[model samples]
Target: MKGQLILLDHLTGPDGPVEAAALMRDGRLEDLFIDSDAPRPGAIYRAKADRPVKGQGGMFLTTPDGPAFLRQVKGLSPGAPLLVQVTGHAEPGKAIPVTTKLLFKSRYAIVTPGAPGINVSRQIKDDETRDALLEIAHDTLDGHPIHDHEGGLILRSSCAEAEGDAVAEDIAAMADLAVQVLNDAEGEAEKLTEGDGPHAMAWREWVTPAQIETEAGCFAHHGVHEKIEALFRPEVALGSATVFIEPTRAFTAVDVNTGADTSLAAGLKANLALARDLPRQLRLRGLGGVVILDLAPMPKKDRRSFEGALRAALKTDDTDTVMAGWTPLGNYELQRKRARQPLTDIVTEEMLQ
Candidate 1:
């Protein structure tokens, strides 16, 4: 019962900070008490300086270790897009960015705009998706301009010796976890009252298909189109407000502004809403590290009531989130486990706009 447990999944992000179990033994959940300071384990590679070879577009470097190093890069596939740090003496003291090519020997996955190696063909199972994948692949891999495809690729992991159905199962499990997290957060938020902050909100509006087409056409003409258009679906639009629940290397600072129409009653109502809603957003966002929240400053009496409400909100999040007392500057500090990249990074820019 005290042994270490390492859950591996290809679909899981590069950082596996979130862990769940059916039971906890003597306060040790899954034989590991989640620590905010502990670093997540995954394979990381950096380009070596000596392996430089100049090309027409720019200079590039090959991993001298050959197929073995390439294998390592492929192994990290489906986790997070590989983070490649470019370094060279191009401008003496300055570093030059280089392009990389990730070769996946297993599956011929298509490279999407934001998500590089995401297999749109496999996911959509449609002709348009397949064609898009192939077109992008051929262009990036064998186009006239000689494109650089150096990034993360998904290949079988030699360390785990995972193969056949086992690898597929691992990928499925990771997807399940991600789905479960989202679903559970949504379900929990629905139980709260309107005065309880908006863990999630939906707005309904009537719009003709023609209106959509016209707007989309306008954006497309401007050379601005997003791959993930589902998020923009006007059908019962879902909006959720999240706070920086955790602090990592990049600190999260939230500014709370009292709305123009807010009254004394509405102000207290909003504060209570934020208190109930903030924790859920933190979990949903997967925000880790240090989070600073600037709530609309209230009277001394209201502050005491707000503190209790805030503490209650923190309990809703399944993740190990801790609410530190408010700072002298009227900001409150909280900590959540940093798992994957922020939601803003995950969503498309056009959808955000």
Candidate 2:
């Protein structure tokens, strides 16, 4: 059971429900998801455009919850109702960021509204499987009266191994939901769909089979509380090296230090170790956007190897991330998608409530 054992634990917090999904591999916390009360990313809303921001080329809209901002508002009229999806978690005291180009995403399919094309994931490489998945997409979507203005379907990678009936059902459900939301344009500012909470999201995305622990206090039982407490601290010790992660107002700063290792390859070794661990750290902490990495003092020739390792690590990761190359001062830059609420913010919000 060294690496084969995996656990999905849903635990209760002091406030009755923490609404967390913790994934443990071989008794080690692998990934964590804690539900946040903030305006969740990917929620669909029928919002009313309030006003346009001059020079910013964006519009501020009013939702049932609060004000939301959308970019590239060329034809959106003031007070006009439009469908929008939350793009990311809102910064503290800022308008919730939203986009008119809405997407209905699920485990097996994604319905792209206003973009018409029935496609399969590129990751589904087998010719026969791709063809079958394509056929399934067409067969399921062809009967639906999807207009040119309406969106198209893209079968997700998960569909390749999923049961055909289940894939078709998932696609159909998303398509039906999209049509319903798009046609209802007469409503006041309101939410059309609430994004998936922790438990539901875990079931959707964490497709690997695992031992399920739904009983309360499972988090503490699995040492998840200790792991989470460590995330609150800035320094993470990776063997003999120490990496400091500090999030500032403008960007998150990461510094790697080779502690007590006087070997000539210490910098490269520590940096390579960081290359693998950094993604997991950022993911669990829910930190995204511009990340500045001040790697240990490695030779300029070793940068390529470090980058290759980093890229490989990120490739397996589900989140969208792009390497923005290095800065003039030898710092590596990464631009990651704002996919989840920061762990700190989520805990603080719950405590205050």
Candidate 3:
């Protein structure tokens, strides 16, 4: 959520949907971007509830995908129709989480049925840009439909570089979807529309952010579709540093290799670059929970500065990340609660039936 979420302009096949990838500031993958799809997280589905398990305080709802758990627990009964927003997908032994508080996400905003003002992402650290986006949000409220929705647009970082027209387009789309959310909430409709406009694009496959050239890289082969396929790769080389990422059952560990340059300055330099890119890699790969960075050796004082850079790098990460401090052995510890499935899980049999 902290990155620039853009749909790759290229289509995989004739009449295919565009691919979407969420990229961090340093341009690393955040998650597999599926713009609009049924059964995905954040999707709203109309379902019918079975009787609540009185002891468990929640009931199972039959959705188009399958049975899901509705945890709000009140006023729900067998055969009751409900409009539920999927909070998460079905895990190994865990039921998918759904709620009545419907959420609609557009390119520039998050529309919900609660508050009535715009809120920008704090990651948009540039004061002027933030102010500009806010002004744009305010403008949307001037006779805009759905302007009355409680949770206003929480501008994504991409809004920082967006032209006024782009922001307006998103606001317009939000307004359109806001109406659906309201209608659904008021029982006038049981369906929720994501939106229509530039942000409501569809995609059939997910490619690495590395594959799509932003204002950055590009490709072509035998007049064929081509891209730098690194979205699922776990290691990256930066200047004199090579960071290796290993995700385990308990935590994700990242090790920095200085590659024969063991001098203090070399180690510090490599660690510095790693510190900056490590957070990008972590967020890119969704390596949440108990992350330990095994950095190139640096003095205690130097590690303090290194830690500062790493923290600075992490500022761009919107996840609930807590820095657990460095150990005496020069390894750094941090915890970013997993928000989505890690790339390894998606690439492996974890998601398989």
Candidate 4:
């Protein structure tokens, strides 16, 4: 059988490394790796002939020494970077097959193939081709007609043990689940569309230009006065700050410091203070979308501490605020949910005024 095989990173966390497996018959998650703690979910795991194996379709095993074994296998096929299989024997006569293969160049053991003595070919290396095969397996199991596209070849799952019919049936069930999810999403969208117009109408009474200017004035007086005042008077030689209301949305992007400030720390601190008070402005402005606060770079420790403060300040906002953490370039991104138009959108006052 051919399908996209996702080898999850070995689970390592607080509870300690948990052994997990995910069986996707088609595109849908079929049977998850059953931990020792929980029972099997459905017929998929129930029908298993033998207990789940660790390496390749056999037992629960982790081999620190297996990498060395894999290296030996790779040596056999010199210059061929894509594929290799390693076999080890647990006991004499019965050779232990510790199959180590690369999925997208990352090595992962194929623990279960659904059957024995299955031969894997080189074609499984191509991810696109593998996915198509799994799709075919799923469609066939569901008794659906194989879709006709450019190359009309039916693909199968990589697991050799699964019977042709079993693979097809699993895929069909996945397709059915997908259809249900899409239908539910579409229904939700329709409800939102029906309710949107009335919601916008309700905001018209409270969101006004005067309210926006008042809020802007408050932000200027307390947070960043020079930058805020500069917005109202274009002729003023101020360090770069551009405030504009985004059209067709309830969000406003107030960019601080377009021009370089002589003191980098001061500029960053100014930006941080502006970011810290954004939630109140969002309430006053009725704007949202994790306000992207692009700040000047500061020390790493200070940046983290500032981020903590920004998050704490946002908590005062009744609306939802999510801190999206910092970027590699040291910009802080904050997401604040706004229910209505911001004060700035209602007001069209020019900087000169």
Candidate 5:
């Protein structure tokens, strides 16, 4: 455990350089991040409202990068310039999904404009630590002209282990950036902030102390390439059971199989195992959207335990996911946010070739 490693490297493709990060635990690839040129989910932009779709309750907006779609356009008029943040990766040839609510997130704090309140992450259960972080947040933001007090600060769980000065600096820096970007909103369709790359993201999100590797070809040295390539295939072996994850044009399909296990509880065991690993599988593949899970033939009575395991797994995952319950045919469904570019789509075919 002390020897866990985070490897950061770059891969060249037809599009240009793609930044990559891989987390290795006990000599196995545990997580991965690959950058893409597509519009990132957290990027903020000053966009001009385009024509509203007559049928859909959303309107298309023009950003410097490309067209973006924003829902609930009741107050926005055509040609009006407003701030928006990219909400998710767009489907092929579709407008990038965006929202008017902007959030500036950093390693230690999240600054929310138009939502004023100083809140601390619930993960820090220590009363003394929470009070200390709240005091730091107030000290950093007390007199700052952040959106005329409409800006709120959220001290992230990372602050628990971080130095007070560092946490305060992160909060102050994000608050200042939010104010600056908001003040500069009276302009053409322009990107206010570029999304963080893989290396930066690894630094921010992978807060657990680990051996960091930045040498070139580190991915190849650590066998990350092979692990990633294996994901191109559908089957992932979990002990004697296997989980198959295949993405389609509309949704991702997941199937659980109990390999040669003839025990009565084989189906229930496989389903529970897949439920724990499903989040990591989807996250590494960067596949999101509708997820249809076809679990092995488990007794209906065991569905509650299966759901509990799945919910617990997803609760710890960073991605937003909602379990939509079981279908008539005993299949389960999940709706996951498209927070990253799909691994297959981002890795160029030529590179694989």
Candidate 6:
């Protein structure tokens, strides 16, 4: 199986989410998750410029979707309506990232709101496949043109494998959504206060209902928050290996060990097995930034082999991760870039209150 789907549910208040986190894991593979409460990477919003920071970080703007820090400095003025799309989600103390170059996401393509041309994802790579998808997208949109619509199509990498009918359907659907978004922004007169955007989970409100029906043995659990809380424990054991996951102010450290009576071969095997769960745990726990791995000691000649094995295990991690190599203290250092609060921290906050 590619992955085991773990349904995530959120506890919510009247306005929106109080908690939402989803986890997906398969045998010895990296885990996948969806942080519903966090700002989505592709959703668009119509924001009004607040005030420029004068060569500082960026411009602050308010929108119904969320408050975003716009990096476009020049020609931006206060109280003007501007359409933007979220480029990144929020972190503990920082605002979410956004851009004026808005784009709408689809299963096979991205629909740019006001642009006039189609382009394919550079990662699609093969010239012939890229050209075929481009032709299909342009032809589909041409036959189904909405009058004076500003919709433009850009094929996603996955479209390289998508059937022609699927591509056409997605293009039409995304273009329709884009048009609706543009239509709404013109009439939107809402203003933002500090509390408005931080808690809403927009994706949940928009998810396709068929998604839950399609996955076998993976239905939304009645107690999603409870499941999330259960997995938030600091340590967990798998087979002969016990993992110690501790998050400090600086970084999160994951240590792997076998019971004391084990021989070197057993311990090494345990370490290799633990490698599969390491990336899975990081993602499930929403651990990001610098991470340290402390595995049981191995032969000097085997260090390279262990690192390669660990790399193979982490190849499925969707978040961009880079191995910073080993540290002087005999721990392996890695970096994963993502923005969100850890589930452990979330638990702590609830416990405190």
* Top-scoring candidate (lDDT): 5
lDDT of 6 by residue, 205-283 (tens): 2222222212322323333344455466777687767778888878888888776537767667766777766777777
Candidate 1 versus the native: TM-score? 0.32
**Candidate 2 residues 245-350, lDDT tens each?**
9988888999999999989999999999999998999999989989999999999999999999999999888789999999999999999887877888776522
Q: List, residue by residue over 287-328, the lDDT tens digit for candidate 3.
A: 677988898866677877887888898876556778898787
Tell how far residue 230 is off in model 5, in angstroms.
Answer: 0.6
lDDT of 4: 0.35
- For model 1, the stretches where C-alpha displacement exceeds 4 angstroms are 1-249, 347-353
Model 5 lDDT, residue 200, Cα: 85
Q: How far does residue 176 in candidate 4 sit from its true spot (Å)? A: 43
TM-score of every model versus the real structure: 0.32, 0.93, 0.65, 0.29, 0.96, 0.68
Winner on lDDT between 1 and 2 is: 2
In order, the Cα lDDT scores of the candidates are 0.35, 0.84, 0.61, 0.35, 0.89, 0.63
- Candidate ordering by TM-score (highest first): 5, 2, 6, 3, 1, 4
Global fold similarity of model 6 (TM-score): 0.68
Model 4 lDDT tens row, 1-353? 23533222223324553332322223322222212221111101001011233354233222222211222231222222221222211221232233333111101111121121212334357666555445544344343222211112223223333345544454454334323322332211111111112112222112111212222233223222233233333131223433232323333344555344566576556556655655544554445654655554466767766767777877555567777777676666666543433333332333212
Candidate 1 per-residue lDDT, tens place, 1-353, comes to 23322221111123542221111222222111111212111211233322222242233222222111222122232222222322111221223332233121222221211223433323335575455444444443342211232222232212122233533443333333222322332211121111100111000001011111222233233222231232122121112222223334566655554455356665556567677666645543445667787766577678878889987776544456677777888777777555433443434443324
Q: Which pairs in model 5 have colliding backbones?
A: none
The true-versus-predicted C-alpha distance at residue 10 of model 6, in Å, is 6.6
Q: Indicate the residue-level lDDT of 137 in model 6.
A: 78
> Alpha carbon lDDT of residue 123, candidate 2?
85
Among residues 3 or more apart in sequence or in different chains, the pairs in candidate 6 whose N, CA or C atoms overlap within 3 Å are none
Which pairs of residues have clashing backbones in candidate 2? none
